[model samples]
Target: MAENKTQATGASVDEFLAAVEDSVRHRDGLRLLALMREITGKEPEMWGPTIVGFGRYHYKYESGREGDAAAVGFSPRKASLSLYGLMYGPEAAELLPRLGKHKTGAGCLYVNRLEDVDQAVLAELIKAGYRHVTTALHSP
Candidate 1:
């Protein structure tokens, strides 16, 4: 089986966020960093190069593929903020409509800016998704 490429790294999350060239992305990245920290109560770690991850979970599939992944994470990409683990569980389906302007792809939620969405709704999504992944989907 192919190993997961995005593994945890010892890189500094603050340094990475500071290096983001776009002012809006930089600001939003900082905001997300703080918000995720408060929500997960877990210190942030760099997952590979770009993703800022909070907490972790291990998974093994029926095919015997297994790996560890962030319980929830986000990447402040140039195009948009790629939010991971926030689109899982039944709560996602119910909350997504109320999350304000955004787009979803595969397992990620993309938001152009933090101002484009309701922060409270985003917080709820993060909390619910974190709970679902850590408790229901994978053991943390």
Candidate 2:
């Protein structure tokens, strides 16, 4: 794994979302914003000027390096909304079928719009990801 040098911190979620709305230049983005709020109870965080992180987690690698990261986050890209969480590393492959339409990556899920997927399923995925990550972090 590569070093997570671009760790995100110190940015207001509201300001970040406002900037994102201005940059979106389209109506579809507005829906995405609403979905984000509906799913994540907390507001988004500006992680590295791109990612709008919802929650946070601190993880330490075997190298003794540690950092804080958004437990589950997403980024509104020009082409798609990059939802980060519930990676397909075996744990998610089975869950993807039940997740509705979308593409999954290492840890990111790509979606064109919120209308195309089930928001409740997305919430479950986020929750699973959060629980999985936190459990790993606290594990002995």
The models' CA-based lDDT, in order, is 0.94, 0.66
Q: How many pairs collide in each candidate, listed in order?
A: 0, 0
Tens-digit per-residue lDDT, 9-92, candidate 1: 989999999899999999999999999999999999999999999989888999999999999999999999999999886799
Q: State the lDDT of candidate 2 residue by residue for 44-101, as single tens digits.
A: 6667877766666777878888777876677767778787766623356666788778
Badly placed stretches (over 4 Å) of model 2 are 1-3, 21-43, 88-91
TM-score of each: 0.97, 0.72
lDDT of 1 at 38: 98
RMSD of each: 0.9, 3.8
